[model samples]
Target: MGVPATVSSTSSTLPWNVHRLPRADGSVFLVTGGNAGIGYFVAEQLSATGATVVLGSRNPAKAENATASIRARIAGARVRTVRLDLADLSSLQSVVESLEVECLDAVVHNAGVALDDPPRSETPDGYELMFGTNHLGHFALTWWLMPLLSAAPAARVVTVGSFAAKSERLDLDDLQSRKGYQPKRTYGRSKLAQMHFGIELDRRLRAVGSTVASVVVHPGGALDSLTPSRPPIHVPTTGARLSAAPAALLVQGKHAGAWPAVRAVLDPAVLGGQLWGPRVFGLRGEPRREPVWNHLADTSVAARLWDASCDLTGVDPGAIPG
Candidate 1:
């Protein structure tokens, strides 16, 4: 059952609120870009609920600090940090190899980037940074770690997609934006690809009889993320000053934005193929309810985008662990 635009965000029968999100006791969870922004809060809130969290960040120092802060805030919480740069595949491989396969109950594909960077930039492996990091790197990492997720009962894989994804037109010839990169377009396309991958992933999971559910969420509002072509960096949060109203009342806080995603991962009742985000039109309010984005249902384009992502990432969706 796909969500239609006619379904208003406020129509949620449960009147969902973030404070009441369900728990994840005795489970191990993984989150990428968990050092700051929405990912930080996602880890914090999950840890608050007694889940063992393995947060990933690009910088070792930053990862350590973020983990320490989480421990400080939630005494006795099981939280650790691993160095993971989505732009770097070697790090993804090393991290996957080190982890105990089949222990993760959930994996949050939360890392992302933005900003108008130089026309062309490449990953250490010479692939385009934006697509490589935002989609393919995460793609490889998740599949490699699938065995771990499948071992857990009712595990989930959540991709932090973007609303801008609805607007991107897949340009297969210039996926990396090699010839002339339009910063926003490149970033937008990567996001779109992520969303498509999420949708296709859901279908693939069912086919394999995997207990894991693949879900997608758009946090809403800009949180200092850059496209892959940009840098892996965290900017100080802007919510304390803005959390009062319009930002709170109008714009969604990155932390607040993460609530829906967090809920989707932990709440067993969440239906598969769900897309979470803000309710008050676009990205301006209510983080708990189903954010109505009617545009995500363009299955044709989504299927094409999914096919392209598979080609680029080199992972056969069918071969993923059950």
Candidate 2:
């Protein structure tokens, strides 16, 4: 498909630069997996705009290093670290209980195992590794933070989705992938579940008259080569550099790739239930609020997934007061 000036009736081509984002001095954002990849860039950009960032990672040292890097790049940048392993519910609960603040401005659900070889096994929670970490982990985290989120006047929950969502179908019977599992398919299914949750979350929040905005976005195909060669944070191997050489033109850097999620979190005009992504090939281009794909719009499927998620994670969506 040719890159058009606009994507659909609801969206227009949005040429954006991270520098154009408004100052976010007093706001606080919790970014999962903020130590690297799109999550790291998102943290850097958010902190650059003066937001207080709580960088969450499974590794305290990595999270600390990421915080140090952010502080180094953006002098006086307010940042902290939180230990969170999404695959573990105990870790999620412990982190939430440790939060000192009653409200959070935004929670960027950006952490997940993407593009790795298929997990040989399931998570501690007994679900497929990809699904558990990508969808279920964020699901539980959001539910646990619902009170803090709802307390904020108008908080936003930005779930990081992927192009993989465009091509995968969910197996309601085997959401855990007990029957079958392929790396790419599993990744796509997890992301699709996330998009479904984001959309349904918006609907439920509105039904309960909550002010939280639930938005989903995908960082277009982001290549490590397109990203800067930041030592410690991202030291590409010779093979990686070689692989990225010919593919550079096809993918954008992590900075440009981070645009959609950042916009989803900060763009005041972005409404709940909206889905955003790159305009060109859904891979690379400016962020645009495009139509939700047909499969992703199936309320029945979303409702089922929501119920399953609540059961699997022991988080009741209805528990959040209307």
Q: Count clashing residue pairs in model 2.
A: 0
**Candidate 1 residue-wise lDDT, 217-300, digit = tens:** 887774432211111234433453443444444465566667767776766556567777766665755554464345556677
Candidate 1 least-lDDT 10 residues: 224-233
| lDDT at 318, model 2 | 38
The 0-to-1 C-alpha lDDT of every candidate, in the order given, reads 0.71, 0.81
Cα shift from native, residue 284, model 2 (Å)? 1.2
What's the alpha carbon RMSD for model 1? 6.3
| Candidate 2 deviant stretches above 4 angstroms | 1-16, 237-243
lDDT of 2 at 137: 94
In candidate 1, stretches whose alpha carbon ends up further than 4 angstroms from where it belongs are: 1-15, 222-249, 288-295, 298-300
